[model samples]
Target: MNKQQKIIIISIVALTALLAWVVLKPVQPSDTATTTTPHEAASEHAHDHSYDHSYDHAQAGDTHDDEDVVTLSDAQAASAGIVLDMVKPAHIFTMLTLPGEIRFNQDRTAHIVPRVDGIVEAVTVDLGQQVKKGQVLAVLASTGVSELRSDALAAQKRLSMAKTIYAREKELWEDKISAEQDYLQAQQDLQEAEIAAQNTTQKLHALGAGTSAKGGLNRYELRAPFDGMIVERHLSLGESVQANANVMTLADLSSVWAEIVVSAKDLGTVKVGSSVTVKASAFESQSSGVVSYVGSLLGEQTRTATARVTLPNPDLAWRPGLFVNVEIVAGEANVPMAVTTEALQTVEDREVVFVQTAEGFRAMPVKTGRSDGKMVEIVEGLQAGAAYVTKGSFTLKSELGKSAAEHTH
Candidate 1:
């Protein structure tokens, strides 16, 4: 072969070998599977803020990435405390929520007044003290009570003296040792003394005073009429009070009144004996009560009427002046589709419920209406007969959040 021909052949042979090596080299296995993290999935699912939509506007036959879905087996779901239920028609209540306040039950509250004028000698009970019926609240010294007792004592003395004279006169008359007129005169005197004594004793009784006092005739003890807590104390040591002046306030706190502010338009729905639910404004506490009162006259300025619900406070959790929300059921509604209030959760600032799917559960955005605190009406986004997570939806939410974080990382 010629030198030029050989050189060309060798170059061609090297080029061909290089091309073969590039084409036939062993292929290292590349990652074949594609995965969607929850974060990416949620971003893809994000939609307009409208509450009216069906299935997030996704078309039928759309398949979701398994990684994007929240998958839990029956055993796994049970272990994670997840519960599922089908969305269906349910009966819901139309609740009228109104602002209210906890207050002392007036029927069981008392404005204490010392019935007689007196100087406070000893104050036994303090504010907020629990007192039993007939417990002495304070001690007082009253000249009026003393005067009544003194008058009673003098009358008794006269009666004793008259009795001695009348007995002798009667005996003398029976023996015919004295004139009938003299005996009759003695008897008249005795009757006058007895009447005077009885009058003074009755006056003492009227004063709630014993005929005699142990410390002094003026000594008096003010007592409670019923079991209650002393809410207010207006009198101090040595303070003199009038007969009718209010000295203290006692309230039976075993029960309380929830006073509701109802506008004129709401009066018709707030009837006496209607059931009510009271929720605390500042804390997570709720109670049940009945409509004990509804005012007929509205406030001239506010155009609102006062309504009351009597609630039993066995634990004494409800206190006067606590703000509360009073929920009164005005009517009922049967919605085509409803889910539990607890099932609803917020995602991307939109309300969503975890819906069950063959792959797993998907957080589906929904529009809701008219919740009675138990069942909430599904207005849009969710179709009837679809199964969704109810009790443990919060757990599913956490899972979604973690998936989103993983994608972020």
Candidate 2:
């Protein structure tokens, strides 16, 4: 019994000691915590790297912006036909462009008419036919012409009779073979006949009819007054034309008129003797002329004044009724910086000119002043001697727009 009790007591005390040691021992961290901390740190490093990558990308985008440029190889430029020019001083004219129409020069235009009533026997000219001065346009059978010739012939015969009688009487009186009254009467008759003849000749001259040697007294000829192109024809064969009937219209096409209707505001700008450029709309012909007339009266219906430019159309290119543009140069100004008008482009509501740079051409905005169609005055944002695109600047503008769109994206 003693041995058994001692063994049992020893076992119980050993079990209690094991339990106390187990309860009093300090706690240690788990392997899962170590593994989780490392995973979190790796995630944080990856996030920081991603942020750095985005920052670098933003910096690169800023660099691109600082140099808003376009680069084209020499071959590409040549193929595009890009022309470059340097800024220089030039005279730019301020011009006022107005709509106009080509018209017959009224000063050199004529409406041919038969002075006496007649029947048109033949029409020698047609519409659009060119004729020289004194060229017969048509022939007529005129009764009035016949009467004029008859009167002239009668007067000539009477003058011949009076001359013979006067000669005989003068000879008799000088020889003292005739009375003084008879000689005086003969002299008075001769004077009367001369007066009648002169009156008849003047009347025939006024009628534009000369005594016909061919005995066709009624023959009347309508002739051209000047060298001109026939623009209109009214008389035909066998047509009866009255006195003062306009048979044909002839216009000197060598010179034409550019009739411009100017507004009241622009009346002062367009004055007589001012130089003008006339451009035909139907064709690519331009001529320079002087303003010959500026009407004092404005049209009541149109409320505009008529201005005329006498253009020499030696080639007959400026036909009547053709539309035209009249550019009146008001004045000229000397500018320090100027460029071709083709070089100027409107971008973002600003006038821009592509300037040559080390890398490429950069679109630069500019302020402009006076301008003719050929050249324009660059008031600001451009310096003399700076190279710029002249002929093909529009292509650069399109390129710039594309670049801007890409940037926005």
Candidate 3:
């Protein structure tokens, strides 16, 4: 309870009062105010702007999907060289093309046979040699021809004698130099001789032999019946050939036949007298012909019917055994809308044609029908007079592919 104790107590009391004043003091407004920096203010403003812009872009992205529009400037379009066409009505013919073979016209072809058995003395023509009608193809030595010609010669001599006897008998009868019975007998003999001679002459004529004074009796000439080419020759010098044996095959190559192997399904369409176009495979020449024949029965092995078309082969271009394609016009159809075949394309396993739009081109799905190789009938998804891309539609397809890829990403 001294002065030191009182000093310590005063210090403690002062400290406690100071702490209490600090704890109990009211919070007054700061003299140095809290202020934001320019960089911080800019950062907050940028965040708000980014949020609003993202929302606006999200709204715009939805429009992009609904409008699958491709925009190309005039310069770009010109550079791409896009070709546009308008759909129109056209005649689209359904055609059936069949494979065929060129063959000889059997109607004008001949298998020459010797009528009488003989040895082939000479063959004047070779295979593939062209000859005119009445041209001798070969000379044959035949005993039968010889006998016929001998008979004709004897008949000629007898006929001359008969004429002499008939004149003498008539003169005798008129002058009364011989008895009436004797003259009548001579007249009868002359008549009988004349009849026998005529009979022999007719036999020779039937055998195509004559009493020619120049050649030997056994000589027989084989001549061409018509102007034709010798496609086959089985005759040789001094070779014996039997009667009715085919010695030569002559063909009048002025005309040929297109043997078309038509499937059974096409039997109803391919008819006789219908026109068809035949295209040769070896060359670029095409010929038109009429279907001359259509077999009623199908071949057992081939399961196809045979149809024939006769074509004139003046130039001999339609050679036998040459392969050909015959396009028969089955029928024709008039369609309301048609487009060029070049405009058609396959996209996503769908047949599509690029239809022109105000903004750009759109790949429009379509259903196609009869096609005549040049024009195609549009069955669905297109209207007449609508603009479509014909030549350069592939470019638009590529552009569409790029857009789809971007959307997928």
| Candidate 3: clashing pairs of residues | none
Name the runs in model 2 displaced over 4 angstroms: 1-84, 331-334, 345-369, 379-381, 389-409
**What total of clashing residue pairs does each candidate reach?**
0, 0, 0
lDDT of 3 at 241: 93
Q: Which ten residues in a row have the lowest lDDT in candidate 3?
A: 63-72
Worst 10 residues of 2 by lDDT: 62-71
Ranking by lDDT: 1, 2, 3
Could you tell me how far off, in angstroms, the CA of residue 76 lies in candidate 3 after the best superposition? 19
lDDT of each: 0.89, 0.89, 0.86
How do the predictions measure up, each by TM-score?
Answer: 0.74, 0.75, 0.63
* Quality of model 3 by C-alpha lDDT: 0.86
Rate residue 274 of model 1 by lDDT.
95
Sort every candidate by TM-score, greatest first. Answer: 2, 1, 3
Error of 1 at 28 (Å): 35
